[model samples]
Target: MLSTTNPFTLKNIADYQYFSKEKIETAIQKSSDAFEKWSEISVSERLNFIKSLINTLTKNKQLLAETAVAEMGKPLKQALAELHKCKLLCEFYLQNSDFFLTGRKINTDGCESYTKYEPLGVVLGIMPWNFPYWQVFRFVIPTIIAGNTVLLKHSSNVAGCSILLEKLFTEAGFPENVYQNLLIPGSDVKKVIENKTVKAISLTGSEKAGASAASAAANQIKKAVLELGGSNALIVLNDADLEKTIPEAVIARFQNTGQSCIAAKRFLVQRGVYDTFMEGFTAQVAALKSGDPMNENTYIGPMARVDLAEEVEKQVNDSVAMGAKIVLGGKRNNAFYEPTILTNVTPDMPVFSQEVFGPAVPVIPFDTFEEAVALSNQSDFGLGVSIFTSDIEAIKEKVHRFQEGAVFINALVKSDPALPFGGIKRSGYGRELSMEGIHEFVNVKTVYIK
Candidate 1:
């Protein structure tokens, strides 16, 4: 049985019976069978179904948001925002999917030459707990709209949200077996991946998990897309406007209790303005209120689980031991970790070198713009980087020097429906959103007719 415990109260919220091997096989087979029909339907009809999904998401926004909070301790407001994003994602596809999927006419020597995007068979998505609803929907909406069926093996901690998603898809009038929620153990994931019916796999989690999943898919000779861990950096230059930069920096680091893959994990400040930035940034982090996620007044909520909190505590303690200084909050009470900032952080410190998936931000000082870019690029993770500066042109010139998937100038990094979201190096491979994302699981067939 899979049990879900409320991270806040440490109480068992619910227990779900895991799907047996037989059930898993049956579900994959059903999805494969459904894909045969689903993929044959016209794009316009599929988009009409997406319209229903948008309506369903809007109708059940409150219930879905509450379920996310109860299941994983996300702030209630953020949870609602997640649901809204899901609706908008569906609408985005509804507006652009036809154009995205349409075959482009190519001018070639042959009488007729073009490329067609065809759907791959059933694609399995192994999603993580952080931003559970958004992560799953981000994968599900596009995969389905691209004419592929999806089978979700969601994080065991957010099992309730998984069930709600399956229900939502059904209520949206999707055909039976087109989308499924598999309640299976982690060990069972490999078996599902190896199944002949599952054509591709997508995962969003730790680097370890991404490696394992990618290996399994490779062994089976199937395609895979991974969106993994990130130790992103928020670099503040001397010319940056502290008033505008400080608040965004704080939100980039501490939002969702800092459990996001793309959240700014390291703060790199130029030596000329490091002190001033720290003064304002530390105060903003200190002012955040840590309490029940359901409370409207709460700015910081508990980490999704106790172990996650403990991990952050250990990272902070080890960094402090290795010569880092704690400038602000660094206390942990049960599952709640105070929004923390560590100053005097060097390249060797755990908070700077590793992916800290909690509410801790380490600020490291650098002397030059070159040094700032170097520090930001010095990570196994190339998920994202944000540079705060008044000179947009200067930043743009140096942007290509930073090794990350996306770079934001004078702004925080985030995922949007119109852009592709993914990372490089240890942050995992392949794209998640946008036109490139829809094409990931599709067969791009080139045809030449004389």
Candidate 2:
């Protein structure tokens, strides 16, 4: 049985649901009971549930987008983008699950043999707030379509958004306890993870949180996947088109108001074009419009919370004190942090090494492609890196040698339903947005007969 606890938070918001020890235990128990029947239903039926959920989401994407923006401070455009991605993921899986999850036949020595894909049973998703709605659905829809039930323990800050999702599933005719959301506290997570019935775990959070959760799951010898935050770097070669690359750097660093795990934080530019790149990039950063996220014109919003914005502010200022030069911005008022750009940033600076989870960017100069690659891979976290160069050979070499989970050539960092999303080192290990993702929480069994 799963041990549960109460939800602990600074305050409560309406439309959120909290699960008690008894409640979560009951839900898991119910899920375990339902799995007997739920797992037996044809994969087609399971997918129908997902389709219904998608249809329901499409009908109310506006309200859901607004709720997430209110709860987590994501710009409304990005929030709606998250909703659209979630819907797209659902439809993609609905059309492709059988191909990804179906049993595959193997060539045997004159005998028949095949590999079977089986559910992991009672999978728990411990997700984050930056992209609340999409994060949960990115893991949930695929797991459900694979015949696995989901138990979501979302970030406390986005509890309101999480509950709305649960209600949507309920309204979509998902049976009780199927794809359930638990608005519980941090203390409760360990208990649920330890439960013998819960077969595996997936988390998207901080390095500290991922380490703790990975340790807990490891101690029990259970399967777990972690998608921790990243300090991804973007590299520009000396041969790159400065005009084309500089503007791309602005969007790459400032996307999501610069709160994404995979957002480009460090810009490694070859010294030949470094000054020109910084001139254009810094201008773009300084001119960004920051205000209420609900305002359509606002590209920059509050940093999800005032404390987070303050921490980022401190990190940028400390970098400046450590010999980093603030080329564009380094100010904060209330929750609004002006998009910041720092040049003369060395690897030793904190902003260069740490995950600056706001509208802050640091630019470093390198002399050669080798130095640029070295700078990009020096960090302990290897989530993603973007290279802006017109040299096809250099792009190939960087893509082959860059130690990140994903490498983008002449483009910014991104996540797509078609590609596997994960990281190595402290960025955490687990694919979340592709077929590889659907397999993360499942068991591959070898069914052989003598």
Q: Number of clashing residue pairs in every model?
A: 0, 0
List the candidate 2 regions with Cα displacement exceeding 4 Å: 1-18
Q: Mark the regions of model 1 whose C-alpha exceeds 4 Å error after superposition.
A: none
lDDT of 2: 0.83
lDDT string for model 2 (1-450, tens) is 222111112233454446778998987777777666777787888888888888899898999988776776778888888899988898888888888988787776747778888887888899998898888888888887777888899887777677789899998998777778876888888988899888889999998888888888998898888999889999888888878887788888887889899899888888888888877887777787877788888788777777888999999988889989887778987666889888778888889878899998888888878888888999999999988877777478547788889998888888888889899999988788678988887778876554
Candidate 1 — worst ten consecutive residues by lDDT sum? 394-403
How do the predictions measure up, each by TM-score? 0.99, 0.94
Candidate 1, residue 435: lDDT: 93
Q: How close is candidate 2 to the true structure, as a TM-score?
A: 0.94
The TM-score between candidate 1 and the true structure equals: 0.99
